[model samples]
Target: MDFQLSEQHEMLRKAIREFAEKEIAPLVEKMEETGEFPLEIRQKMGAVGLCGLVTSPEYGGNGMGFLARAIGIEEVSRVCAGLGIALQVHHMCCWPLETWGTEEQKKKYLPRLASGETFGVCSITEPSGGSDPMGMQTEARLEGDYWIVNGRKCFATNSHVSDIMIIVAKTGTDPKGRPAFSAFIVEPDFEGFSLGREEKKMGFKGASSGELVFNDCKVPKENLLGKEGEGLKIALATVNRVGRPGMASIGVGICYASLEEASKFAKERVLGGKPIANLQAIQFMLADMFALAEAARILNYRANWMMDQGMNCDTEMTLAKYVATENAFQCARLACEIHGGYSCISEYAVQRFLRDAWVAIPSGGTSQIAKIVLGRHVTKNF
Candidate 1:
């Protein structure tokens, strides 16, 4: 694989970096203080093409593909991971729709999503179903011209801000007693659909992480995504491609941030009348941080590049998510240690990076789960 990024990608990176530094940086202080993201930022992102990366131009989307999307996410994340996460989740909401929705569904929703007229969310996690698809308690029953959906979806990002949602619920039991699932393009105006208690998370604070409550929510029959009993398939594919790559992008951004923070501190911080950069210990730490950051980036970029090439890289994406997130955590912790007592204080950005790193592990599915998938791949292939 060519290690060099295309001129288009480089230019894209420069554009995003400039936008994030100019627009997003000014808002980070407020978002960190209030845990409330500005809706205006989403609008601005759409204007800059961040919101339409995954979409086709036929539907008012840029259709740039995954690698470009990852770069955009990573650059945005380098300044504020929370906003980056919100953008990524918005793309996640777009993925199944474009991949599975009817042309009419595309025409109706894609333009709205592409333009950031409203945020889009994919809500599937439930109190009963942490990782197991069959454990989903959200049930949908087909009625005349609609489906009645009833249950709570937890940890749904953009819960408050989103007007469009890709909702997954169990529709029936299969012949083998497995819970069959279906996906829907639900709107906030749908009857019985409401926002539940918002979660006060330790990280990704301003992403509006919360619950999606559907109490006999009525969705039109035409809004169903893909074939019947394909919700699990849709969910899995989205998670494998859009979800995991997003996590990796955030991880890579954090890793790079950690490296920058650590390198700067080591160079400027004084110990025994000399800058800590004079010490071999500090040098080694910086070296490791740099190496790991680059490694994570290479892994994540390779996975997304493979995806853009139309290859099924489930195992590769899983590994990239695992390594990138875990390395991010480790690197952030090291950066924190380099900050010494200063790291514990809220004033330091490294502390925030550490918190966000921990949250990243569980966002796209936990690191433990990634290991299981990778372990299975190892056993099956090796």
Candidate 2:
């Protein structure tokens, strides 16, 4: 198997990394201080085709597929994981609209989404719980030409800033009396729909994560994303196929950041009249960090490659997400240790890396959920 990245991929990586260092790095301090998502920066990323990587060429996208998407996210994340995850979740909204949207819907929304004319979100979580879809309290009822939706969604990414949001709401009951759900596209002009409290997260400070409130919201029937009762299927596919891989990419980026910072500090910092790089303990710690970073890269890249090839890789992607995110947290801690007292300071990037690493753990799916998926897959097939 080939281990090296293609020329094109390498070029894309370098370009994104350079862009992050030059363009995004300058804004990190301000963004973190205020906890704001940089809409202008997102638009710039769209101008460069980063926002439209997986979108079709017919809609002005580059059609670069998941590997390119992962690479872009990873490179950006290496400099600033908040922006990396924000970009990743931004693609989450685009994925479903492209894969499941009707021609009319795609025509109307994909172009704008691709151009970053407005941001998008897939709102699924509720106060009830996200992992358990059946427990969701959000419900919608069919009216004349519109559906009246009433619910509250919390911990939704881009809730306050998104212009286009696809929301999942219970529409009916199944044969067993379980709630049947459907997905709908909610526009900014939708009546009775408004942004709720914006959550101040511990990490990813610049990336918006908050609540969406829909009270007697009027949504036209045409806004239904797929066939009725298909919301669960679409939500599952989108989260597994698109969200998890993007999250894995974020983890890989954080891993890279950890190793890079640790290595740089070890080489430069002097201790006992010599550089810390000469110490066996420091060397072993750096070696471990390096290994974890490499492993994260391999797992995340391979999972994204499988997605690009149109292979069924949910389990593979789950494993990648679980391992990469967990290792990223661990690696960030190690990097902080290598940095000594300075790592705890907000001025150092290592502290930020550690914060971002913790946030990634449960973003796509919890590491516990990932293991359950793997366990089920092994038991069912083996």
Candidate 3:
């Protein structure tokens, strides 16, 4: 019932906002222009403890929890949606390692991931598609001292940049003849592993999305992430727990930025010898945007709070993800409409925000998929 952010959360939000405005705002234009990931900013993000918000302190992370992670992603996304998503997916990769890794695995990899010395990724979607994880064609077989993996995963964020990745592959058949999947930790330099071409996308200009190819990729037996045949659990739990909420935060950020941009432009833009802010139509548009953005934020924060409380929040996370992403797209569209002809011009950031808003739609899962998740929950509980 309480809606207020704690003093610590408030302070974290402010610090992240200031960091984005100072450190990242200046680079936004260049990133959009170049369509390249800013590798230089990785260490700076690490230095500020932004890389490991949900990771435990024992492994050199801040151990701030998921709410802090949402706040950080929101503030950064308010300035740059691409960067926000990059950081979010980065956390997506780290979640399995931190949550499911063994004690030795944690010590060996968590420190580097926490410090931003190495980037991490999790690849589940393969060339066939992402909708069915079990249907993925990637297969791994046990050898003498290693697992030889062969498959191709597509639409992976940070595919070109990540040093380590959690790879999901079919290990064998279940007792019922269903595919048995397992998760493994694979290094990019491993034999038969290669980075594939990057996909040119509609938005998220500065974030990298590409394919990963594995041809007899060798992974040590020690690198198995969890018990054999548990890949589906790891992937599903991660998407529900981390991935959906992360994308929702990005949507909230896009909506927030749209509101700000539309408001500023309306106030400064003159019409009938007065500001457009004085017009009833402009006022109505802004009001709608404000409501949507506020609602998205509340839903996002609520889901994250439930997560921090160790509750079953899969339904909440999906609802937030569905609503936030849909509303973000609507808000961005309105902001562009409010700008009129200027929205079509590349010179204005509204156009870019609009493009980025579209990308958020399918980042975690499509809105229809989210609805299916919520529908199942409703059918079961209601």
lDDT of 3 by residue, 128-237 (tens): 88877878999999999999999899988888878878879999998999999999998888999999989888798888889999999999999999899999899998
For residue 381, model 1's alpha carbon misses the true position, in angstroms, by: 0.4
Candidate No. with top lDDT? 1
Q: Which parts of model 2 are misplaced by more than 4 Å?
A: none
Candidate 2 local distance difference test against the native: 0.89
Q: What is the C-alpha local distance difference test score of each model?
A: 0.91, 0.89, 0.89
lDDT of 1 by residue, 158-223 (tens): 999999999889999888988899999999999999999888889887879889999999999999
- In terms of lDDT, model 3 sits at 0.89
- lDDT by residue for model 2 (164-278), tens: 8998999998888878999999996899898899999899889889988999999999999998899988888888988888889999999989999999999999999999999
- Sorted on lDDT, best first, the list reads 1, 3, 2
| Pick by lDDT: 1 or 3, better one | 1
